[model samples]
Target: MDEANRSDPPKWIQQHAVYQDLMHLDVGDSAQVYAFFLVYMDLTEGEEIAAVVGVSCPELQAVLLEGREKEGEPVQMIYPLPSHRSIKHRELRSILDRGAPMLLCAVASDSSLVYQTV
Candidate 1:
């Protein structure tokens, strides 16, 4: 695995109680969890920009890929996920800025993915 390709979840997600439990119990490695769901806060536009990157679900990946394909950008940034869904930094920032926070939720069958940050 390329060290540069290893991405970590956003700090807010890392500080969440559910995330803490997972880390404490060693339920999964950081890299593996990241492969499924990625969340981050971008503080570039004088405020916090939060985004949730989901690649574990095939349906979502297809939707995003199809959308990107229609947009004329055939290629996207590849991540460590099995499906190979891509998300570039600039695109991520755009998603974070225009995308709503609720869209960041993990869209998967795992009940554990649902959690309240408080």
Candidate 2:
């Protein structure tokens, strides 16, 4: 597999201070919460992504919990697959598509947000 096709965490995840901190968190749930926020950023676009950044931890937790209870908005659908198999195929395609842009956003420990596109 090419470098982009490798099934490994992206380089930004390895280098980001906030992501590093989240990984080191003793509470597994806390780490998952923050991870979900990172995923949320990736799936969101334009103003929605901006709106979610810098939210307090408690607010982030609430949004994550709420998402689990309901279907996500249509705009948030990253793929059109109706089955798990097709979704997995699309995910693999996404991983291999090196030219595709990935957005990385970090919420610092102090609750400040920064965004970068790669």
Candidate 3:
């Protein structure tokens, strides 16, 4: 695989708590399927412990394969981007600006395409 084509989730985010316990965690919508679910944050632990990233919207879409992509195994995401509205989004923006490593999530038309962080 090309170094740029790796789609491993960010190291920090754990599998969803329930999925972690169950071991077989899959995420899918009506037509497609995803085997992994990335956790972006543990908000209940409070802000000081969160892993944040300075990500742009286009960059995010790239992560999801809505933009450019690296070639390799198919990668599909069951969850779409969170709606960026309201005061909470403002705070999320601040976290990214601080240069924290965040679990950026996304999906592609083909599950086999390897998504990369440009």
Question: Which candidate number would show the highest lDDT if scored against the true structure?
Answer: 2
Q: What digit string (tens of lDDT, one per residue) describes model 2 on residues 44-112?
A: 433343223221223212112111112443211111111111124444344325333333334443333
- Tell me each candidate's RMSD, in Å, in order: 14.0, 13.6, 15.1
lDDT of 2 at 6: 34
Supply every candidate's count of residue pairs whose N, Cα or C atoms clash at under 3 angstroms: 0, 0, 9
In terms of lDDT, model 3 sits at: 0.29
Poorest lDDT segment (10 consecutive residues) of candidate 1: 61-70
> On TM-score, who's better, 1 or 3?
1
CA lDDT scores, all candidates in order:
0.33, 0.35, 0.29
Task: Write model 3 residue lDDT over 14-53, tens digit each, in one string.
Answer: 3445334323222222121121222123221333222322
**lDDT by residue for model 1 (32-61), tens:** 344333322121122332222222223223
Q: What lDDT score goes with residue 27 in model 3? A: 25
